[model samples]
Target: MRDIHIQAIRVHQYGGPGELKLEEIPPPVAGPGQVLINITATGVNPVDWKMREGMLARPLPFIPGVEASGVVIALGEGVTHLKVGQAVYGSVDGSYTACAAADASRIFPKPVHLSFEQAAAAGGAKIAWSALFEEGRLTKGQRVLIHAGAGGVGHLAVQLAYHAGAYVIATAGEENIDFVASLGADEVIDYKAAPFETQTGQADLILDTVGGDTLERSYQLVKSGGTLVSIAGKPDEAKAAAAGIRAVWSGAKSVRAMQEVARLLDRGLITPAVRKVFAPLSAAAAAQEYSRLGGPGRGKVVLLIE
Candidate 1:
């Protein structure tokens, strides 16, 4: 026990960003198989805002972030893979605080070439990798369509699929067409210009980060025997069955895939595009809101705790 308190943004009640309150709280201790971190930065994802809105239920007064980058401050009993003072990045349950404890396996050594902000920003790569490879089973030479190509996860999905030899087609607003294209997308369709289904031909796989109508429309674009994977929500199974394709909702966390993503990032084969970084931790509300609206900027939004 450190016998010290830290500032954190907690959600005492489920509502909107207004419910995210910054308050002083006791720093959490590392349990066995866990590591305590002095969080320097956190990645803002839709899941954070969704959890704030009560879409994902948790105990009251819990901190509200899932991905973070920081230095290891303490190691739990039996933990030896990582040493104190080493920088790392990984999935965290409550990252919206000055310090947090994470599963030892979840945290990976931060790449020497990556800043804490970049490491935090790159946390979404795990989700992207899981959706594209593990769930969607994307392979080389296959046509894959990814929605919201400029988003936190979508941008990374685009690059990963493209580099994997998949013919990458991504849907973005006109302003982001060139930006998504630069991320290795073979084609960037301006969704505002028209319905993406019409602009994009049939695909072997479709990764939907933007759900609802976009997901509903994507069913028709997957060829027979193709797969549609959604991290946003559950796809309509009836529609998928009728279309003769597979529709799956992916929420599973892949630690192995995250390790591979870290390797790719370290080698410079892929990179995170951090669009905006908010400072002082109090800016978490604004950062979450910016991520929710898919702000004027492209790629990930970050909250710099320092």
Candidate 2:
């Protein structure tokens, strides 16, 4: 076995961004149906912060990131589909490191047009597709409402909904209203000035990226036979039935879905809203943490892991 010590971040106990620390750790090895990737870029998403904040179910003593773009360095048994040295991007366990061992199924070919940072940005966008098309059953010519339109998921959802022929409506702070509109939203709401539910009457589909009261209020915006999907909070089934709409909490860990996103990237049907990249794990983690808490919360915060 090759001895590999890599720079990585680990959370021993969840608390805050201050708890995230960089250390030298053994690089993950490819197991069955897995491939070892030499990570080039790592995406810092809300989930990373959420996981650190104890919002996720994953327990302590786990590596911190999930989205990365990298080159395949090794393949374990039954991983004949991809060759070593192929550039790939996808979601994986413990991706906040110089190398990651990921299930081969989740990895997808990186489109030639996308840089490593761009590919890393697609992680959240891919999950947004699953929420809108796969779970929400969004259709063309429908009215689609996407909350937090400038967010990692919402911006992509806006573009996806727009390209699908839906009338896209988005909510964002005043600063990002134009940014969201540029991403193809038919209408942009200044969510700070007014409540989104009061502005949008009804929608065929609703992607709720904002949870809490925003998620609860979304039930009113969904059309009679439409669906509201969220990656945030779980919905009350009884309330959904009463409102005559389907409420689903959706997520993606799908190979086919990642492939679909990759295809879209190749064709230029959708573009990721990537604003910045930080070099090194410690600085990247801190920058992402600051952005998640108080900085401009639009686009993706990526870590250049090389």
TM agreement with the true structure for every prediction: 0.97, 0.94
* RMSD of candidates 1 onward, in order: 1.5, 1.9
Best by lDDT: 1
For model 2, what is the error of residue 281's alpha carbon versus the real structure, in angstroms, after optimal superposition? 1.3
Go through the candidates in order and give each one's C-alpha lDDT.
0.91, 0.85
**TM-score, candidate number 2:** 0.94
* Model 2 / residue 128 / CA error / Å: 1.1
| Candidate 2 per-residue C-alpha lDDT over 186-302 given as tens digits, one digit per residue, 9 for 90 to 100 | 899998897887776799888898889999989988889889898888988799999999999997646667787778888988888776778877775675665577467578888
Whose TM-score is greatest here?
1
lDDT by residue for model 1 (1-306), tens: 656789999999999889989999988999999999999999998889988998888889789999999999999988999999999999898999999999999998998988898899887678889999999999999999999999888999998998899999999998899999999999999999989987868999999999999998899999999999999889988889999999999886788888889889989888888889999899989999998877887888999999
Q: Which parts of model 1 are misplaced by more than 4 Å?
A: 1-3
Over 4 Å off, model 2: 1-3
Given candidate 1, what's the lDDT at residue 33? 97
